[model samples]
Each structure stands twice: as structure tokens, then as C-alpha cells.
Target: MKKGFRFLLKTIMWFMVITFAFVVLFKWVPVPVTPLMVIRYFEQDSEKRTFWKHDWESIDNISKNLQLAVICSEDQNFLNHNGFDIEAIEKAFEYNKKGKRVRGGSTISQQTAKNVFLWPQRSWLRKGLETYFTFLIEVIWSKERIMEVYLNSIEMGKGVYGAEAAAQYWFKKPAARLTQYEAAAIAAVLPSPQRYKASPASPYIQGRKAWIVKQMHFYGPFSYDKK
Candidate 1:
């Protein structure tokens, strides 16, 4: 029992050292690839399944409209929360208990951590690791850095990641040049990017885009300053 306990403790210590180095290293340098990208490459329909468009744009390079749109749609309290949104978590839990339209309350921070470090799984272990990484980034990275990484690293669509790539694919423009409406449309498809089209205007996407535009206005102007 003592030997097993010692081994487990050593493993955890090594994990912490490695993860801390990784998070700090990524704070300045762009992440070249993520676990999700690797996972998607393997879980493909045919050979050369992954067709990635990962242009790592700096936070200032991406449109503020896209940032606002995502904040409005995904996690409004991103600037306020340390890692998790308590009210959203409570609401999601309540909704989940009802067994009706089940919901998730993962903050952008959480999603960033999960997307970069962990595999896409609904397991308790993944959640636990996600919590750890989320806390690490929240503590180590400034709000702007977190927002920068999130905007540049998330899966915008099938084999498509980052704002730069998404903007180019959907609007044939650079991410920095995206208009407010275009940004909102991208945000609208975020809930299920692979399932929804951001262009040629599906009614569902249009409706969600309209709602997101209102939310962008509702949330009002904000900045990603350090808290």
C-alpha cells in the first residue's frame, strides 16, 4: 500500500511540473497543435481526415466583434469568473436534473483548457483534469491572454480552428476585418459548428445570429483588461 501510494504521488507531482511548464510556455508562444486536433485526425472518415486551417492570430489581430459575440453567446461572466461560472453551473445542474434540454455550463476558460490539453470525453477524469488546467490558466494568464488563446484555439468548424481561419473560410476576409454581423453569425454556429452553416444563410443560423447580435448589444461594450 505504501509503495503504491508513493508511486501515485510521484506521478501526480510529475504531471503538475509538466503541465505548469506547458501553460507558462504557451502564454507567450503560440500552440502548434492540440490534443483535439490529434484526436480528430484519428477519428476521421478516410485517409488525410484532418484539414486544419490554424493561423495563430494575436488577440489584437482578431476582431473585437468576434470576441464580444463569443462572450455574449458562451460566457458573459468570463471577465468576472476565476475559472467557472457559478450561476451558469447551478442553472445547468437544475436543467439537467429535469431531464429536459440538458445543458452544459463550461466557461470559455474551461473550454480552452479542455481543447488544448485534454481529449473530448464525457468522463469524470476528463472533468477533473479540465478543472485543474482551467485553474492554472486563470491564475497564470491575463484576461486578454485567455481571450486571445480561446479565440485562436477553439474548433470553429470541421478541421477548422481559430478566428483567422474561420473568417477566411466563412467570409473570405481576415479575422481583423470581420464586421459585427459577420462575427455574430460565426458565434451563432459555435454551439454546433459542424452541424450549422455560417453562410448561405440557414434560418436557424440566421435566427441565432440575430439573437447573438442583440446579446452583443445587451452585454454592452467591454474590454479584456486584467482583473
Candidate 2:
């Protein structure tokens, strides 16, 4: 028993050390493959996809509507939270308790961590890794950087990732050119973008878009600028 316990402890320590080393290496080394990128590649059944890589300039550089719409629809307190938003999690827990299916309380940061670094599955082990990566990103990456990575990595559709890809595929325009209504529409389908189309005319899509628009009006004019 003692020998087995010592072996298990050493194995766990080695795993942690290797994981940390890889993370540090990846931070400095730009890899051609990311988890989201791989998923998109598989979804499209093609090897090539366009990714929008933009440096931070102004919110306008990526469409103020997109930024506002996401915050309005997804994370109302994105600017204030430190990686984890306990209040939202508590609310989600309560809401899911009343529902037939379990709901989620993932903030944009948490979503980014899961989408970019982990595989698509729900397990306690995956959740643990997601939490670790979320903490790392929140501590090391700026808020703008987190948003940028999220924008660049989220699955927008069957073969699409990022605002640029979704904007082009859905609206035939660059992400910077997305309109308020279009932005809201895009944000509306985000909960299940892979399964739902962001058509403004669809009843459910329209309703969700309207709700997001209202949220923007309620939460707009507040600066989400964070470091």
C-alpha cells in the first residue's frame, strides 16, 4: 500500500510539472494548432480557414456592437469578475435545479479557457483543468486579450470560429462592419451556435436578439475596459 501510494504521488507530481512546462512554452511559442482551431478544421471538413487576428486598438476595431452584444447577452459582469463569477454560478445552480437539464454558469473567460485549452466534454477532471487554465488566463492575460482570444476561438458555426468568420459567413462582411442588429443576432445564437443559425427572421432568433438588444440598452455606456 505504501509503495502504491508513493508511486501515485510521484505520477501526479510529474503530470503537474509537465503541464506547467508546456504551458510556459506555449505562452512564448506560437503554435499552429489550438483546440478551437482543430475543432473548426474538423467541423468544416477542410484544412484551411480564415482567422481574424487583430491587435488591440479600439473597441470599434472589432465592432462596438459585437462587444456590447456579447456582454449584454453572455456576461453582464464580465468587466468586474476575476475569472470566476460566483453570483452567476449561484444563480445558474438555482435555475438548473428547477429545469430538466443542467444549465451552465460559464463566464466568457471560463468559456474561453474551455474552448481554447480543453476538449469538448463534461467531466470533473475537465472542469478542474478548465478552472486552472481560467485562472492562468485571468492572471496573465489582459481583459482585452481575453476577449480577443475568445472572439478568435469561439465556434460560430459548423466550420467557423471567431467574429470575423461568423460575420463573413453569416453577413458577408468583416467583423468590424457588423451592425447593431447583426451583432445582436450573432450573439443570440451563441448559446448553441453550432446547432442554430443566426437568422434574424427566425422567431426564436428574433426574440433572443431583441432581448440582447434590450440588455445592451440597459448595460451600455458602462466601460468594460480592464487590464
Candidate 3:
């Protein structure tokens, strides 16, 4: 029993060291691929119907409006939070308990952690692992680095990942050149990108885009350098 405990301790220690090193390495390096990208590629449907769109443009290559728009739409307090938004998480918990509707309280940091290191599914194990990885990145990576990875890694449409890909496919331009409204339009579809079009004006997207623009005006020019 003592030998078994020793083995477990050693194994866990090795995992922490390895994962910590991996996370730190990514702080300076671009992530070539992520777990979700791999899963999306292998989903039999992806080959038959959906073609993946992804290009890793640095955060500096993406527009400032887009940065503000996503922050406004996804996590209003993204710059302020550590890895989790405690108030939002608490609200989500209470909202779920009432069974009124289902809502997610995942902060941008948590979503980045999930997209980068974890798989597509919700389980206690996944959530536990997400929390662990989120804390690690928050400690090791800057807020700009966190946003850079999130914007460049998240799924924008059926198989699209990152700002450059989304801009090219939707707006026929580079991410650096997207207009404020164009950026907001892209941000608006993020909650259900597959369901909503960022162009050609779906009524749902039109309404959300307007709202996101208002939010951007309120959020007012957040460059990640602030953090």
C-alpha cells in the first residue's frame, strides 16, 4: 500500500511538472493545434460537409475593435478577472437551480483552457481539469496572452477557428481590416456561430450585432495591453 501511494505521488508530481512546462512554453509560442480542432476534424460530418477554416494570426494582426467586441460580448470583465468570474459563475449556478433555462458562466479564460487543453464534453472530470488548467494559465500567462489564445483558438462557425479565418470567410478581408460593425457582427454570432450568419443579416444576428455594438461603445476601446 505504501509503495502504491509512492507511485501515485510520483506520477502526479511528474504530471504537474510536465503540464506546467507545456503551458509556459505556449506563452511564447503559437499553438499549432488544439483538442477541439482535432475533434472537429475527425467528426465524420466535418469531412462530408464542413471544411475547417483556421489561420493563426497574432493578436496584433487582429483589429482592436474585434478585441473589444469579443470582450464585450463574451466576458465583460475579462480584463479584470483572474481565471474565473465569480459573480457570473454564481449567477449561473442560481439560474440553473431554478430550471428556468440553461446558461453557461464560463469566462474567456476557462473557455481558452478548455479549447486548448481539454476535450469537447461536460463532465465533473473535465470541469475539474479546466479549473486546474485555467488557474495555471492565469498565473503563468498575461491577460493579453490569454485573449490572444482565446481569439485564435475558439470555434467561430461550423469548423472555423480564429479571427483571421473568420474575417476572410465572412467579410472578405483580413482580421486587421474588419470594421467596428463588421467586428461586432462576428462577435454577435459567437454564442451559436453555426446557427447564425455573421453576414447576409439574419434577424437574430442583426439584433445581437446591434446590441454588441452598443456594448462595444460602452466598453470603449479595450486593447489587451491595459492588463
Judged by TM-score, which candidate is best?
1
Per-prediction TM-score? 0.96, 0.81, 0.94
lDDT score, candidate 2, position 135: 86
> Over the stretch 1-227, how does candidate 1's per-residue lDDT look in tens digits?
99999999999999999999999999999988888777777788776675678899998899999999999989999988899999999999998999777699999999999988999878999999999999999999888888899888888888788999999999999999999899999888887877887886699888988998999888888966635
Residues 41-113, candidate 2: write the lDDT tens digits: 5555255654433222233457878988988888888889998989999989999989987878999999988
Ranking by lDDT: 1, 3, 2
Badly placed stretches (over 4 Å) of model 1 are none
lDDT by residue for model 3 (115-213), tens: 999996999999999999999999999999998998898888778899999999899999999998999999988888778889886898889899999
Question: Any runs in candidate 2 off by more than 4 Å, and if so which?
Answer: 1-32, 36-60, 224-227
TM-score of 1: 0.96
The lDDT of each candidate is 0.90, 0.77, 0.89
